[model samples]
Target: MILDALFFLIQAGLTLFFWAILIAAILSLLTGFGILDTRNRFVWALSDFFYRVTEPAMRPVRNRLPNFGNVDLSPLVVMLLVQACMLLVGAIRGYMIRGGLYF
Candidate 1:
């Protein structure tokens, strides 16, 4: 019972975090090309928020990846990593829920 509840919480938390990272990625793409002007206060604030939220996850990846001049691929890498982590957690929970090794 407790394990079930814990699994649910983990699933939900990972899902929400995945979405947050996705949104930040989209906002970054748009802002990078100036499709969304940051001159306005609201836009600036929103962009800043996304930056603050995603920068930590992205910076390390960015540093490790080979630079492509103007292109940024850290967001894509981070998104893939987040998805992999979510899948790994879900699979582990599923295995435990089904009594894997005990069987």
Candidate 2:
């Protein structure tokens, strides 16, 4: 029972993390394209927060990747990695359930 609950909690966390990364990626693109202006303080703060949170993981990837004539692909790569992590977490949860490792 306890193990099952723990697995559920982890899955929930991973889902939230995945969604956050997706949102951050979208926001970054919108800001870059000037489609989503941060005139409001709230928008500014949200964009700033997301950039800070995701930049560390993205910086290394950006440095290694070649820019395609003003197009930045770092956010896409980061989103892919985030999705991969979510898939891995789901697979582990499924394996635990199928193997009867959790009660």
Candidate 3:
């Protein structure tokens, strides 16, 4: 029972992280296109929040990746990695449920 709850929490957190990376990417594009103005306090705060939430995960990936000039691929890469982690977590939970291992 506890393992199931733990797995659910892990999956939920990974899902949130996945969406954060996605939103940060979309916000960047909008700001770049002038559709979103950082001068507006609300827009700036939202952008800042997502940036803070996603940057730590993205920084190493950004550093290792070759520069794409104006385009950033780190968010996409990070989202993909987060998706993989979610899948792995589900698989592990299934395996454990099947009596494969115990935590």
Structure candidate 3, residue pairs in collision: none
Q: List ranges where model 3 is wrong by over 4 Å.
A: 100-103
Lowest summed lDDT window (length 10), candidate 3: 94-103
Q: State which candidate, 2 or 3, has the greater lDDT.
A: 3
The residue-by-residue lDDT of candidate 1 on 7-96, one tens digit each, is 778878767777777888788788888899989899889889878877888899999999899888887888788889889988887687
lDDT agreement of model 2 with the native: 0.79
Compared with the true structure, the alpha-carbon lDDT of candidate 3 equals: 0.92
**Residue 61 alpha-carbon offset, candidate 1, angstroms:** 0.7
Q: Residue 95 in model 1: shift from native, Å?
A: 1.4
User: Superposing every Cα of model 2 onto the true structure, what RMSD results?
Assistant: 2.3
Error of 2 at 50 (Å): 0.9
Model 2: per-residue Cα lDDT over 62-103, one tens digit each: 999987877778877877887787788778878988998856
Q: Provide backbone clash counts, one per model.
A: 0, 1, 0
Tell me the tens digit of each residue's lDDT in model 3 across 1-103. Answer: 6787788899999999998889999999999999999999999999999999999999999999999899899998998899899989888887886895755
